[model samples]
Target: MSESLLRVVPTVPDWVPAQDAADAAALVVSAMCPGAGELVACRYAEVTFIDQGANFEAVGCPVCTAPLDGDWWQERMDDAYATRFATLDTVTPCCSATVSLNDLEYHWPAAFARFELQVRNPGRGWLSPDEAAQVSTVLGSTVRQVFSHY
Candidate 1:
């Protein structure tokens, strides 16, 4: 089974009613991706904190585009779970550029949420910003995309 997923999650601004979130998720699945029916399976999931485990395997410094080393990886991952909007400061190994951990791109296997509208097996698929805005309009909250694999 393919473990890959492309998820849509609202940045939990405050406590959203469960019914509203579910309704918005259904609408997002139906309206966001026309080909989702053929290319992916959509579902709503209740996110558990334990499931916050790392989904992405590789991370690169956004400034220098250098792959982060083990030390940086360990430290960042540790912080990610401990804090909201986790960030770290370190020098890029490739170019010695000072940057924050938030300035990194995580590749496959990255985890991005505690609650999600999951699109399974979305091969090279993405939800556009306009689509996310549509979801936001419906949910009355900001929505963002997160990619991952199991």
Candidate 2:
């Protein structure tokens, strides 16, 4: 019951933003499902506007990047999605037991700022909880900027 998320190769290049190697190609991972029609397409981010062999790419800021070690990657993977992204002081995972984007807030709920999520029955790509959170961040920022006049 996960959303259709996309999957891409996990590698970074000189032109791509190296924000946290872990996230270098995470979006591509999720895109696999969406592209294949597993999840509904709420938003889409194309990295570098170039489709490599198969997958697309996304660019993060330099500040988000860091030299990685196995331990750090595993630890971040273990940590709640929100915690890793926002460095939240507290975290709580949503076990709603169903795939529904209806609950997603227009604004980030302070409590789940750094939590992770797994979309169900992806028609296209698979967005891990943290990747989903980042998706929200991008969507929210874009929405606010575009509709500021409203």
Candidate that would win on lDDT? 1
lDDT of 2 by residue, 9-128 (tens): 212111222344334233533553453423222212321111112121221112223222434333533452333322312211332122111112212111111112222334432345
Alpha-carbon deviation at 105 in model 2, angstroms? 26
Model 1 Cα displacement at 79 (Å)? 4.7
Q: Model 2, stretches more than 4 Å misplaced? A: 1-39, 42-61, 64-66, 81-140, 143-150
Q: CA lDDT, every prediction?
A: 0.56, 0.27
- Candidate 1 matches the true fold with a TM-score of 0.56
Summed over model 1, clashes come to 5
Assess every candidate by TM-score. 0.56, 0.20
What C-alpha lDDT, on a 0 to 100 scale, does residue 9 get in candidate 2?
22
lDDT of 2: 0.27
Q: Which residue ranges in model 1 land beyond 4 Å of their true spot?
A: 11-18, 33-57, 63-66, 79-103, 108-111, 122-124
